[model samples]
Target: MKVLVTGGAGFIASWCRRELTARGHSVLVMDHQDRRHQLADGEEFFLGDVRDATAVTEAAAHVDGIIHLAAVLGTQETISNPRPSAETNILGSLNVFEASTQYDLPVVYAGVGNHAFRLVGTGCYTITKSAAEDLARMYNLYREGGRVTIVRPVNAYGPGQSVAKPYGTSKVRKIAPAFACRALTGTDIEVYGDGAQISDCVYVEDVARAFVTALEHTAVHGPTERPVEVGPLESRTVNDIARLVAEYAAKVTGREPVGIVHLPMRPGEVPNAVVKSDTTTLQQIGMTVADFVPLEDGIARTVDYYNTEWLPGYLAA
Candidate 1:
């Protein structure tokens, strides 16, 4: 099938694009042509922004379905200052929905899950994503001919992740690498507040697969599906995650890190967002969480990626 994937160059979207191509589907990736999201040959990756409905419609014109993953991310974008974040996530989503309306295509709306639904710091991202996510479900209902599928993902991280996007995701982004970086460089890891907030992280690969599965389920169950979830089999605590990162970084990089630095937890932080889905609903549609990379492995893999990819390019001269 020909799929029009928005933001295909992003961390999770790239992983999904890889999987889609592997499965013999042609993907038209529509992104802002940022360096991070460039496309290779044999794929029709375009330099188009999701905020531009005309561009989205044209790009999605020949596609059988649409995967909308592009958005303004993070809590800082929310709590610190909000207009851009709100516009990108909420209004941007409306533009995509408009494109779907124009083309009469099935849309897999990749809405908020981690920060949007469960406990996440900051206010902007969660509020907008949640608002947009809610709107996604209401789209087709409002328009008789519209078809939309909503997928909410929680705590997704792995390769191709932006550790510097400066929102809540970035804040979360620093957590893993901060610990590993500290272990490797013998530096102090940055901690925002007390080290007791519980969170969950899904591998980028898992998130990519969930994007596909969400679309497939939308096809099988019809487009107006309410809420489809995809994430790890379970959740993890911050301390658990940090300890694993320190331990694994020590083993891999031969650097034993110090204990975590305790700070105050951010305001409005959900002490626990351990979302155990009634995945029974997902199972009915043949979508189940199969592969959940362990936190230690997630950390180890992150450390390796940072050493091999992140720090090498970004380390100051």
Candidate 2:
């Protein structure tokens, strides 16, 4: 299959691109950033923004299917600037759905696995993501030949995870790497609020597999067949993650364990929460919670990857 992957340069989308290429599918990666250096042999690249409908339409012309992963992720980024978040997550998604409808293509959309979307007090990130998902559903319902399979993934961490820059800083990374970097430097791992916020963190490889699996299967558009939620059975607290990252970073880099500092929770962020989807959906998709990579092992691999491959450049910079 010839698949078009938006946001192909991102942490999760990069893994999806790898999984797709490894499974003998040709990939057309569209990202504003040139990630051609990351492409496998026979994979193609397109330099454009998802907000540009014309660029998306042109790219849609050649692909058999679409894996829509482009978005302005992170609560801080979205909450700080709702305008760009809405523009990228909602309008950018509309372009993908519209183009897919026009080309009569099947789509696999990336969705969040948080139940916070159902609850009140959700932030702009959740709000925009929900709106985009509604557009996907509308496309499936109203447009002929429009098929979309949604995959809701949990918090993912692994090799190639980017280190987040400070808020309002130039570089932006994820939690796992942020903690890992702090751990390496013997700096305090900042924990917001009581630090009991729970999250289901899956390995990037596992999440990527779920995306490809959904793409391979025909759209199970039944009313109950919602976005297939994919993640490990186990959940971890933010405090636990901080401790583990510091512990592993010490072991990998021969550094001392870092301290943890509790800070007030950010506004509009969910607290003491964990999320997962129905097991029946996974069973129907030939998957099980047991298939997910164990948290300890996944964290170890992530720490090692950052230490060996990513940390040097970060330090140099």
Candidate 3:
């Protein structure tokens, strides 16, 4: 299969591209920025924005399937700049669905597992992502043999995740990268709202596998109504994650554990919220919670990446 993966240079999409190739499929990557190190032999990279209907339509022309992953990320960032995020997330998704319908291609959409359910009083990221998911379902309803599948991943974290602001493009700080970087540098690990808010942190590789599995399932059997939720079985509190990162940083870098500071919750964030996955659809597609990477192992690898790769680059710059 030849697949068009929007945002293929992103953290999760990077893994998805590799997974597709490892499974003997070809990849056509479309992204606004060329963040990729180098395209593998025979892999195609198209420099285009999903917000452009012409670009999206052209990219979808010859691909057998579309894994739409392009979007303006970060809850706080989207909330601060809603229009661009909406244009990228909602309008871009509309273009993808329209092109898919025109070309009769299968689509595997990346949905937000945690925020999609928060309909009222949510941030721009949640609203736009949920709206995009609805567009996928709507496209499926009208088009015959619609192969749009939604894959919702919760708190996806891994090696390639960028540090927000001065270090990377993300406007808002992500928990894993924030904690890992702070711990590695012996800085205070900031925890918001008493650090009791729970999140289901799924490894990026596992999330990528789930996307591929959903694509394969949609290709074999038609689209399903239930969105496939991808994550690990266990949930961890924000405090737990901070402590783990500090401990791992101590072990990996031979430094003492860093202090964890408590701060007020950020805007558009809910306190004491627990986000977990419903793996029924993924199970039907032959993925179980057992296949997920262990939280400790994932965090260890993530911290090591920060220590070895990300931090050095930031410091050099």
Candidate 4:
């Protein structure tokens, strides 16, 4: 099968594209072409924005399946600029759905699991993603030839992830790479709020497999949308994550372990929460939470990547 992957240059999407290609499928990656990232060899590329209908349609023209992963992600993007985030995530998703319906292609909608609980901090991110996810289900239900599958993935982390990106005029990093970076550099790991927020962290490779599974599954078709969930087998608290990262960084780099630096919690984000896989939906999609990568091993690999790959390039630039 020839697959079109939007946001193919991103952390998780890059892994997904790799998995798809390894399974003997031809790939066409559509991305904004960030200078910080590079496309994989032996795949077609589309340098365009998902918000443009013409661009999406043109890219979809030759693919049998579509994996819509492009969006304005990150807490700062949604919190600071809700309007553009909504425009890109919601409106841009509509363009993908329209093109999918027109071409009669199957599409897999990558969604967020955090929205299953009450969103605490800047919710525009979840708001827009939820809207787009539901739209894909709508297309599956209402349209004659639309085939849409939904996969709501929990917090994912692994190698090949950037430490930070430009947010407004400043740079901010997510918890995984940020903690790894600070630990390797002998700096305190910043913990927001009370550091009690529990989350399910899955390895990127596992999440990539889930996306590919959903894309290839044929039983998902109907007006009612049931999202297949992907997550780590177990959940860990923010403090636990920090401690583990400190330990791993110490072992890997032979540096003294760093301490935690507590900070205020961001608004619109939840606390004391755990992202668990919906086993019932996983069964529906012929998957199990047991297939997820263990937290310790996943973190170790991610930290190694940050220490060996991400940090050097980040320091040079």
Candidate 5:
């Protein structure tokens, strides 16, 4: 199958591209970045922005399916520029999904757990993502030969991140590596508010694989079915994540991580949150969570990947 993955150069989408390529499916990664991270040699490439209707229509002409992952993620960033966030997240979905229908292809939009369940201090981030979710559902109908599947995944961490920038900077290169690197440098990892808010984090590789599984099984769409949620069964708190990163840094650098500092949950915060969807939808499609890498274990692996691979690749430049 030929699949076009938007944001193919980004963290989670990069993993998705690799997984699809490994399975011998040709992948055409469409992004404004004009690059695919960790790209498989077999995969194809198309350089364009998701915001451009012509790019999506052109790619949809050749692809069998779509993995829509491009967006302006992060709360601080989204609220800082609400209009861009809205246009990128909401309008981009409309353009891509509309194009997919025109060319007759199934599309899977990457839905975050927070979008369906809680708002938190996410501000416009939640609102914009929610608009896209609604748009996906609105377009979910019996077309000639196209389909829409919404994948609600939890917080994902792995290689291909960018958190090495200065303080108060909004650059998050790689989610897991950024946190782990910060901890190793003895930088205080910031917890938005009270660090008790729970976040379910599946490894990026695992999340990528689940998307494929969801794509393969039509039962996920239920013919009569509507919603699809995919991720691990459990969650960890912000404090829990900080502690795990600290532990990994301690082991790698041989420095003791005393502990995480307590903090407060900001206004409009949604605590004790997890995306709830009908498990039967995914089960019907034969999709189940696999490779439950414990947070600490995933953190340790990510830290090693950063220090050995990512840091050298970037710092040397």
Candidate 6:
């Protein structure tokens, strides 16, 4: 199959692209970043934004399906600057869905796992993402023979996640990267909201596989009503993750474990957000919780990556 992957230069898209190629499929990547140098033979890259309808339409040509992953990420980032997030997450998604309908193509959309519950009073990221998911459902409902599958992943983390900056246009702070980076440097790990909030952290690789699986299933069996929730069976608290990162960083770097600092919850965030995995959909698509990487193993690998790859560059910078 020839697939057009939006935001293919991003972290999860990078893994998804690799999985696509590994499964003997050709990919056409459309992203704002220039990653043509990374494209393998038979794979192509188009440098463009999904918000541009013409760019999206042009990229949709000659592709059997679409994997829509491009978006303005981060809870605080989207809440701070809601315009761009809405433009990218909502409008860009509309463009993708429109192009899919025009081209008669299947689409596998990337959605936030907590969007189902976070809709009421969450940040712009969740709101926009939820709107985008609704757009997918609408398209699937109205378009004749439309095939759209939504994969909602919970707190995906792995190597190559960016560290949080105190001041930036994109205040994208992820827990795994924040904890791993601080712990590696022997700085205290900060846990927001008394460290009671729970989250389901799914490995990026597993999430990528879930996308491919859903894509294949949608192509063969048409769209499923329930979105595929890609997450581990078990969930962990913010405190559990913080202590785990500290322990792993201490073991890897031979340094003392870092302290865990509690802070008040940030705005536009759900305090008790936890993912309830849709096991029925997972089983229908031939996946099980046992297939997911264990949290300890995934976190250890994440910490090691920050220590070996990210830390040196960070210190040098």
- Give the Å shift of residue 71 in candidate 2: 0.6
Q: What is the TM-score of each candidate against the true structure?
A: 0.86, 0.92, 0.95, 0.91, 0.86, 0.95
lDDT of 2 at 240: 86
lDDT: worst 10-residue window of model 3? 113-122
Between the candidate structures 2 and 6, which one is better when assessed by lDDT? 6
Instruction: Give the lDDT of residue 50 in candidate 1.
Output: 71
- Candidate achieving higher lDDT, 4 or 5: 4
Rate residue 299 of model 5 by lDDT: 76
Task: Record all residue pairs in model 1 with backbone atoms less than 3 Å apart, i.e. clashing.
Answer: 74-168, 75-168, 78-124, 114-154, 193-263, 193-264, 194-263, 194-264, 194-265
- Local accuracy of candidate 6 as per-residue lDDT tens digits, 201-310: 88899999999988888888888778888888787887888999999999998999999988878877767765556655777678887888999999998999888888
In candidate 1, how many Å is residue 75 off?
Answer: 0.6
Model 6 TM: 0.95
Q: Give residue 253's lDDT in candidate 6 (0 to 100).
A: 86
Worst 10 residues of 4 by lDDT: 163-172
Off by over 4 Å in 5: 36-39, 117-122, 167-175, 219-226, 263-281, 310-317
Each prediction's whole-model lDDT (CA): 0.68, 0.80, 0.86, 0.80, 0.70, 0.85
Error of 3 at 250 (Å): 0.4
Q: Which residue runs of candidate 3 sit more than 4 Å off their true CA positions?
A: 35-37, 166-169, 315-317
In terms of lDDT, model 4 sits at: 0.80
Clashing pairs in model 2, backbone N/Cα/C closer than 3 A: 163-173, 164-173
Backbone clashes in each candidate structure, one number apiece?
9, 2, 0, 6, 10, 0
Return the lDDT, model 3, position 38. Answer: 62
Q: For candidate 4, lDDT tens digit of each residue in 1-317? A: 89999988878888998899899988888987752346666788888899899999999998988988998876655677789779889998999989988988888888897866534444687888988887887787788767878888887788876656331122446778878888887889989888888776788898898888788774244222478888776677889999999999999878889999899877667666666777568776678878777889988999988788866766676
lDDT, candidate 4, at 148: 77
